[model samples]
Target chain A: MQLALGPLLYCWPREQVLSFYEQAAGWPVEIVYLGEVVCSKRRVLSLDEWLDLAKHLESAGKQVVLSTLTLLEAGSELGALRRLCRNGHFDVEANDMAAVNILAAAGVEFIGGPTLNIYNPRTLAVLVGQGLRRWVLPFELSHPAASELINAAPASCTCEVFAWGRLPLSWSARCYTARAENRAKDQCEIICRNDPDGRLVSTREGQPFLTINGVQMQSALTQDLAPWIPEMEAAGIQVLRLSPQYSGMDEVVECFDRLRRDPGDQEVLRRLQSLAAVGVCDGYWHGEAGFANTANGLQQS
Target chain B: MQRMKLVCPAGNLPSLRAAVDGGADAVYLGFRDATNARHFAGLNFSRDSIQQGVQYAHGHGCKVFVAINTYPQPQGWTQWQRAVDEAADLGADALILADTGLLDYATRRWPDVARHLSVQASATNPEALSFYHRLFDIRRAVLPRVLSLRQVARLIEHSPVPVEVFGFGSLCVMAEGRCLLSSYVTGRSPNTYGACSPASHVRWEETDQGLESRLNEVLIDRYGPGEQAGYPTICKGRFRVGEHVYYAMEEPTSLNTLDILPELMRAGVAAIKVEGRQRSPAYVAQVTAVMRAAIDACLADPQAYKPHAAWQQALASVSEGTQTTLGAYHRPWL
Candidate 1:
């Protein structure tokens, strides 16, 4: 299976974003998803800058898709979606129906992003009628469920699973990051950039529960589904998506790339566990609580 | 301007009858199975009750809408299809659906039957509303509980289909259709199992900290003795962010738009929905009656509409946390 670099979900400096992709062009991944998928206030790089990055990635033999925001509330955000639809070159990953509507109207074959909520083959077929070429399995699907949907999917469509990073579990219009700092979404400064990975939220007993990264609520534990690489390959999975975190992402991608080739690399999974700042989990793949890791006989801690 | 329709919930036959008698223009309910959200035991309607509920509602000039809104899993696709077909055969007024495939089936099988997009569809913008309207010929769309009042007004003006906004009920801080926080903690979710924080996994224990509610051993909240406790919804739980411990996602509050009835009327909203299908018959009656009176008062004189003191008091008695906010509507952001 080929590895695809998912979008940079966090807000970083423009220079860091540019340089990350410049370095990412040399990574072992074949496909790269660019642009922000979480908040609209973050525009470190404009559409042209994203296109420029796309061109840069393409020149380095990477297929690029511009990912749109999962939630769109304002007309300005809609305008940006319209611009992404007419970007003229790179395909769009339609995060919401608003993006899908615009992309379908533009008559472009686009990838259905994880947030589209395609669970069954019929939903997949409905989108395929509107030119859906590839679809990302939503983060909540279990391994068996994912297999069922993937088996029934049209052969022309490439199925990609979110194989790494903190799983985004919830989203809201009121920014939890701003709220954590006692700030309003309209007047507060962009303090969400402070937590490069994401601000951790734990239960009152101090057990990790979730991560507040701007509007999106992610799992405090990073999900490492690399242990399922061989099974996914046998299940006809063509692509594995690795969401870019703030640190150790290159090595994470390399590990997934190398592990796909050599399934017996027991040390690779251990190294990946060391790389995750908040630990690892594959409970969603096991059809259990998403925060617990039971795969590969790992402890729940 | 025409008075907006007030839609309310009905968990069982008593609630269905209560909503009709309490002056609901429409009462939406779900099947007994997992095909709908609120799949709690002793809640929802059976096929026989659906028939009776529709007759009772139609007899009272109140519409009956059967909700088959949960995303149909691959294994249970036929169950959702059966729900739609049963709702159609039972002579319901509309089918509230969220899954695209179910909508496709309903569109093909019952083209003449009215289709209303469930809030679980999370169609916040006009483009999405148009997508449902064009694709499924949906008669109306329920807006997710995330848009500000101004955003709602602008969207209603441009939407191809009529718009419905929540009037009063439990608040969802996050988008309804996309959130997986419940399934993250419990194996069941609104999208898949039609239940958020399913009670089968909930456990309330007396601990040293206090009376604590846990979902599958995950701490939800701790309350002092005799203090009011909320349902174990993960979103409203107290959690620590950095140095502070509080309701990091949302407080245990209900969304009440009683203060903004006139503004909603001015916005030309087609309907006002109350957001509890798991509540009791008394709750359905009280909320439906208060909302009916409020809508009538607003329509009688938009310039001089006010939520009555008794109305607010009665609502607060049955509210989630004895607190209410014009959530997302008034932009209670700061």
Candidate 2:
């Protein structure tokens, strides 16, 4: 199975984003998803800049796919989606159905992001008919469910699973980050840049429960599926998607790369656990609570 | 302007009858399983009950809609398929579906039956709405509670199909189908299990600190003395972010669009949906009655339309937190 870098879901400085891609060009991953899948207001990297980065990554032997936003409420966001669909040079990962509609109508083959909510074989078949080439499995799917969907998928459609990173739990119109800072979504300055990894939201009992990205709520636990590589491979998962984090992404990619080459490496799993910024969880894979760390046999803290 | 249809929720046979008798133009319900979003214990309709409910609604000159909205697992796709077939056989007016797979199945098998895109589909844009309409031949699409009035107006102007907006309901702070907060905490979610923050996993503990509401052992919120504690939906819970503790997403409040009844009607909204399927028959009757009156008043005199004070009081009495907001309809909320 090949490792694919999922879209960057957090806001970062333009320089940091550029340098991260520059460094990622040489990483062990074969495919890189470049674009903002979170808040559309995060315009640190414009479409032209994203296209430029996509070109640079292509030159470095990495297949780049531009991702559309998960939620679209404004015409400006739809306009951006139109541009992304018609970029012409690179494949677009359609996160919402708006992107799917635009790309399918344009007769462009696109990758289906996890948020598209494809579960049954018929949905997969329909999208495949609409020119879907690859589909990222929704994060909440259990191992057996993912395997079933992948096995039932059309022959031409590849299946990718979210293998690493904090699970993006939900998206909202209200920017939780801005709300936390006591500002309206429109009037608030782009304050999400202050949190490269997203701000942690802890329970009243002081246990980390979720992470507040601009408009998205993510799990506090970083999901590590490295321990289940063999199961994923056996299930015919073609690609493993590792979402970009603030730091140590290269090391994370390297660990996954090594595990892809050699599936039975316990040391690599340990290294991945150490590289995680939060506690590791594999519960959703086991049909358990998403925050539960089934690999470690521990309840969610 | 068309008289806005008042769609009411029916969790059971009684609720379905109540909605139909309480002046609902239409009543939407679900089967007693995970095929629909309100799969709670002692809630939802049995196969026989759905038939009876449909008959009652049809007898009362009201339409009946069956919501088969949850994303079906690959192995359990047949259950959802059976639901569509049953809804059609029961002579339901429409089938509210979210999964594209089920939409495909329903349209292919029962082409004559009307299909309305459930809000759980999260098709917030005209492009998405047009795509579903073109592909599945959906008659109408429910707008997610995340769009502002201006956005709704634009979408209505551009949409290829008719649009329905939520009028009164408990607010989901996040997009409906995409939220995994329930699954993250309790392993069952609205998308998969058709329930959010399932009561089986919830615990209310009285402690020295306060009355703590926990969902699957995670403290959602702690209420102080005399503080009105709402149900522990993870989104409305207070959480500590950095040095501050507050409702990071939103406070526990219901959505009441009574004041904007005229605006919505002027924007060409076809229907107003009241969203409490798990509520009691009384709750369904009250909400459906208020919304029915409000829509009629707004459509009767669009220029001089004003919300009734009694309607607000009736809705607030049944609201989760005894308060209401326009939710995403107001730009400031976003």
Second chain TM-score per prediction? 0.98, 0.98
Worst 10 residues of 1 chain A by lDDT: A292-301
Query: Considering summed lDDT, which 10 consecutive residues are worst modelled in model 1 chain B?
Result: B325-334
Task: Give residue A58's lDDT in candidate 1 (0 to 100).
Answer: 96
Native contacts matched by each model: 0.71, 0.89
Q: Which regions of candidate 2 deviate over 4 angstroms?
A: A297-301
Q: Write the per-residue lDDT of candidate 2 for residues A274-297, one digit (tens) a residue.
A: 888878888888999999887783
Model 1 segments beyond 4 Å from truth? A296-301
Index of the highest-DockQ prediction = 2
Ten-residue segment with the worst summed lDDT in candidate 2 chain A?
Answer: A292-301
| Shift in Å, residue B119, candidate 1 | 0.6
Q: What is the CAPRI rating of model 2's predicted complex?
A: high
